[model samples]
Target: MEDYYVHPTSIVDAGASIGRGTKIWHFCHIQSGAKIGDGCSFGQNINVANNVVIGNGVKVQNNVSLYEGVELEDYVFCGPSMVFTNDLTPRARYPKGHMGYKKTLVRHDATIGANATVVCGHTLGEFCTIAAGAVVTKDVLPHALMAGVPARQIGWVCKCGQVLDKNLHCPDCGTQYLFVDEKAGICKCGGGE
Candidate 1:
């Protein structure tokens, strides 16, 4: 029951769990059974459905809806107006409840840009970046930069949010990645040099 901020205009259900320092802004609705971690921010018009779990330091921008079966790991960034689909097939006549909803996982430090659409049943790897307006149809590899329709891996990115150079180094933050194996993939260097 640590202190948190929920705007007067927002409605947080009785059984929802909000961690310390989290803020739910105007017009947001947090349903019962939702778990939000510390220092997270949910902007205006957001919806946190029942059974949803959001990890610490996550920043969810305006107009985002987190449906059931969706899990966001720590330090995840959900941009403005992004869409998350829980059901792949929809028939208004045939309704699929929470039991039918597909699970979606956004790993730690991932950035899903504004207006992006993440289809259900996919895992967005840690530190992956999904570009604005792109539609993610499959699992994204860690540190990969995805763009275009159906989202292809255009290049690799650094944890600092910069596209990695030819040497697999971050130009902005000085983070370096050492190529371990072509199959096993690159690993982040221990300390910034």
Candidate 2:
């Protein structure tokens, strides 16, 4: 028996692989060669393009598309209407096809907020938070809290999604983090270990 649930209006192509207990909701289209991991939830009007890989426990909200060359790691959250580009430059007349697509990787436990636009070729680091309406054009650091157009790292965040203080401690969760450098850090209290 099939392990996943696809809404009646959704179409999961024959070669697509959906893991156990995943739920694909209304108007979703999962193209051939897509691999979706266990317990993922995809909301309405979503598209999973060929070869897109979505990991376990991910949550993709309405109107999002996982295009070719985009990968979501485990427990990532994609908010409603978020955009992900696969090409740096796109022309209707001169299509680059799949060969020209650039990869955008959202690492484990990251959260991309509503209406956010993630340009191709960037990696959103683990536990990073992209605030609503932000435009991400470059790589994000782990635990960074990014906001604004052409997103900048305004602060750090905890694995539990709380903004961290300057001392790298989460007030909401009381988890401590240690900075390895200006751009990298790790949780000291085993929150994201």
Which one wins on TM-score? 2
Q: Where does model 1 exceed 4 Å of error? A: 180-184, 190-193
Report the C-alpha lDDT of model 2 over 52-75, residue by residue, as the tens digit: 999999999999999999999999
TM-score of 1: 0.95
Which pairs of residues collide in model 2?
Answer: none
Give the range of the ten consecutive residues with the poorest summed lDDT in model 2. 184-193
Q: What is the lDDT of residue 57 in candidate 1?
A: 100
Please identify model 2 stretches exceeding 4 Å from their true place.
186-193
lDDT of 1 by residue, 108-135 (tens): 9999999999999999989999999999
Q: Each prediction's TM-score against the native?
A: 0.95, 0.96
lDDT of each: 0.93, 0.94
Q: Against the true structure, candidate 1 has what lDDT? A: 0.93
Clash totals for all models, in order? 0, 0
Model 1: which residue pairs collide? none
